[model samples]
Target: MGGTVVRQEILGGVAVLTLSNPPVNALGHGLRAAIDSALEAALANDSVRAVVLAAEGKVFVGGADISEFGTPPRAPLLPDVLDRLDGAGKPVVAAIYGAALGGGLELALACHARVVGPKAKLGLPEVKLGLIPGAGGTQRLPRLVGPESAFAMMLSGEPVDAKKAVAMGLADALETGDLVEAARTHALKLAEGGAPVRVRDRGERLDPATRAGFETKATEAVKKAPGQPNVAALADVVRAGFDLPFEEAVKTERTRFLALVDDPRSKALRYAFFAERETARVPGLSKETPRREIASAAVIGAGTMGGGIALCFANAGIPVTVIETEQEALDRGLARMRATYASSVKRGSLSEAAMEERLGRITGAVGLDNAAQADIVVEAAFEEMGIKETIFSALSRIAKPGAILATNTSYLDIDRIADATDRPGDVLGLHFFSPANVMRLVEVVRAARTAPDALATGNDLARRLGKLPVTVGVCFGFVGNRMLARRSAAGERLLLAGALPHEVDAAVTEFGFRMGPFAMSDLAGLDIGWRTRKATGGKAPVADALCEAGRLGQKTGKGFYLYPEGARTGSRDPEVEALIERTSAEHGITRRSFSPDEIVARLMLPMVNEGARILEEGIAARPGDIDTIWLNGYNWPAWRGGPMHWADSLGLAAVAADLDRFAEESGDETLRPAPLLARLAQEGKRFSDWGGR
Candidate 1:
């Protein structure tokens, strides 16, 4: 006899309670209620000597149903259910397979003993959601594993495999055979002995000297994630486990956990999590839409971006052919690919054998004829439309039928490039950021004539490459780069308006960006922009002058900042500051000091205004799509959500007012509030609240 989500069976006095929730066996209200009744029945039956807990799925229990978050609490909360398991008079053994995460791992910890399959992984990853474990995990984990180990695991939110779990004393043993049989045998032995030992009764494993310095040590461990209160709060909860009684410690953890769940940071992280998953979903695209298989790929160029793109395909277990115009270029590209994997091997991130396997998947060619056999050909040749057109035109003639021709253009017209080929429906853009293998964002640019299957293929390919693809319409710079153009413009203007490169960078860094626009420009080489500006007859006197003097960023040791010999970090150069002042005088513009707040407002408001314009222009599908691009691709700070989400948080009226103020002060029409922004502000609405596509 069984309930809806849990079933019970008796074998030789051992009652096996199997959670039968499909998929991941998420602990929802029904599952919790079923578990409670099952446990009660096992305890009430005098013939039942022990209870073996297991779940019927690939995962023992993934975690709590995330869909239930932020809703009203139901009866028999997770904490209450865990309390029953922890206090059960009969011995309880957990059979963990696949992943036991968050509340699932907490449930296992509440049991008397844990037997894990060889491939099982256990973790308390609540910190990733800006939460700490609420169901006595903080109290019990430290007692099972030492405070330092628990602190590291919870803070990092990474899982430990069965072997690592056993080594850390989190799991009793690992089972190589059938997990259910192993767990039943273990439970039978414990039944004959006595009541199973409870984790709450275990003493702290850390020495007195280590315990004395735990606060400082744990604080230092999480120093990299600054401004995250959950990190500090998690440390406090873990430390409480060492000093406070188990029940009191659990209450304290629950209090902190609930508080963090309500925090803005947590809310933003949760929004980001959902937004990332939503990016895979296309509104008009049907789930029944057929996708073309990308069995083999060919890359046209052999430069940095091309090599990285090749690596993405090769790492995904697809055979890739890299084509360069010359053998020397092909050799150089292959060497760089090997060197990159070699570095990963040295860093212990990739095994030597795995690197060799990926390298073996990538072959080289010297011409376009070699690409005829490829199912997909990515033109990473150059940003020039002429070069892309020539490549695609050749691919159209020589490539296999039904081959998807993709251009890796950053800021070019994909429709125009597609026009060069006969099969416009087969042509699209796969704009990857620098170091394609590492970056998670890919803009799947859909040309006006793109076929539905081709668009679906682009989305599917990104997923296979372990990338987040945001399908966008053809436009300059697409979504992320289009908004970034406005930010770059503001940063450059700030340099002429009395803010030094480092000062602008400092304000941006303080605002939670990894690097300032000027610092990024310096690292990416000022010459690339200089060359583009020269072609377009554009002028940034300070930057052009820096390039003219051969200060091509860290490559030549100087640009907006100076890099000492062999040093990656740059220092502010007084000469660069003088150059900026001279450029201001030459341009007949008055230089004025900008406060950090003013600088941030000026830079960020323009980006938000551009985002509104992009939304109005229909280049991006939704505000969340733009946010997804920036969050995953541009390092827009996940804690802030994205620029659009952040703008909504600031209130559209406030952002509109800032845009108007900047436009009036600077006389730059681009700073004027976008129509959507102005209307939304006037109507008392938010970008997030906007439901339009």
Candidate 2:
């Protein structure tokens, strides 16, 4: 902790204060205090003509130290230190490298000029954490860059590289060589010119015509991000700041930031931010645990999922073979992969050469034997136990000894598949969501006999493919799909209880979900779930009847909703509504109206209850694991954190009470709160408090 300090040196009348906080030089209380003292010393020395703020390590400063979050205010707050830089008598230049994000970027914005390393990334990404830039960034950045550019940076929370930064006027120049010396030279040059330009004084982009764009963006902010208030707050700050004095605007921005710090949406976003980091770590498993190297990959099927899985490997620069049983199937799969890449190329998102290179990494073959040479082979075949067993049996014989055998089963007994393999320890579940290359979540399901290294390899491979891996003990549907199943059942119950599909969907979408269950069913094809229900001898009366009537979804143009002329978004179908009413009466159930709030409660609360059960049963090690899976895979809104986190946010005791009331009202035992949840609620504790226990 003592090692994080600011080092200052006077170089030929130029003072260079280099920040030395290694591993993301976060501007903590101590570091901010040290920076303030160093700046004061540099300013007091008459010999020092200019001050160049630099860092010793690769990163300039990632952001404010999150470890100090929720703690009491300390002297020399980040705003105060940055304010000192803003009003410094001498020229101040920020020598940035790696990242200058959030408060770090705010610091740079406060400086008169910024000199960034070639690889430097700079941005005020505070809106991602559900807060506007507090340290004068909202005012200063808009003044420096145009309102449009500022909106793009702040609202999106994406960092720009040095070259882009220089273009946007975010950074003055780029330094491919000695960053500190270059910054010092830049600072000295500014000093020679007398009174370096401050961002607050720059109003070129704040003209009336340019300021009109702010209103447009302000309107777009509400529509683009509904549940998150930070976007609207940013627009309000910047639009209002356009009229006020710089200092007054900065003060207003700080007030808004502090208010947002306590907003439920902000709290949830912050929780999700930390939860993503925590999910990367495997509890009770040493970081040093040896992992099997996944140098090459192969997928057993050439269908949508298999091709997408192969693309993930190809995108990650790993050569992968996509195998199919027939030549036609293999050819079709390869074409689908090419078409997917071609779409990116057509959209200018991917260059033709890059697409060709990625496509080149993927080879299609007509046999399971083709996967024998790969280091890791994933069976993305149909979700059938017999098919999985057959593939694993073949893979056990064909694959080289110690090769990872992964099953891309959304919901199946992985242990049964592993049993067919000669080396059950090598077998595990690698459940990639639909459109596998696009989705971020991958469930690394650990079978009872799965080796630790095998589990580690699954995690390592998922990371390599740029996916979030949450290790979980094997169960039906693992974490995401299992929780989703609960929601599906609840949704069906609502349908029978007289809630229209559109009404239920409206409630969910209003609650921040991208799509409702019925709409999702239409897009995914109602037949898929209908088939699953048929296989399991389960019941989804309306969904099954829709399939039986050949209303197969968008392909057939009707299901729970109508997708006329192959439209993506579905419209309400009168027939479906009549069918739902008929089903309610057929079950001797009296129809009742369900308000949007009631529908959302019925849809979401059951999932939370099941999540509690998942945690208690040891299927998931922590609430974060389930939340991470849901947040990434199941279309759970990031702003809500996840079902479990949302429950915690709503007050666990309240959630438990609601669950009990719903259970009694619906006469559904599954809606009853899980014992673990009840216990936590009784104790007034959050899921976070459960920890590794």
lDDT of 2 by residue, 1-693 (tens): 223488878998899888988788888887898889999989999999999988877788999987776789998898888878888989999999789999999988889999999999998878778788888889888888888889878988999999999998888999889888898888999999987777888877888889777788778877878888888788888987678888888888888999989888898888887788887778656788898878899999999999999999999999999999999999999999999999999999999999999999998898888988999999999878898899999999999988999999988999999999889999999999989999998999999999999998899889999998989988888888888888899999989988998889899899899888888888888888887787788898888888889998888989888887878888888898999899889998898898998898888888999899899889998898888888888878878989989888889999989989988977888788899999999999999899655
Q: What ranges in model 2 sit over 4 Å off? A: 1-4, 208-221
lDDT, candidate 1, 230-347, per-residue tens: 7878888888876787889889999998898889977777777777777777766888988998899999999999999999999999999999999999999999999999999999
Query: Each prediction's Cα lDDT score?
Result: 0.88, 0.88
TM-score of 2: 0.95
- How close is every model to the real structure, measured as TM-score? 0.92, 0.95
Cα lDDT for residue 459, model 1? Answer: 89
Q: Top TM-score: which candidate number?
A: 2
What lDDT score is found at residue 680 in candidate 1? 93
Question: Residue 524 CA error for candidate 2 (Å)?
Answer: 0.7
**Given candidate 2, what's the lDDT at residue 109?**
88
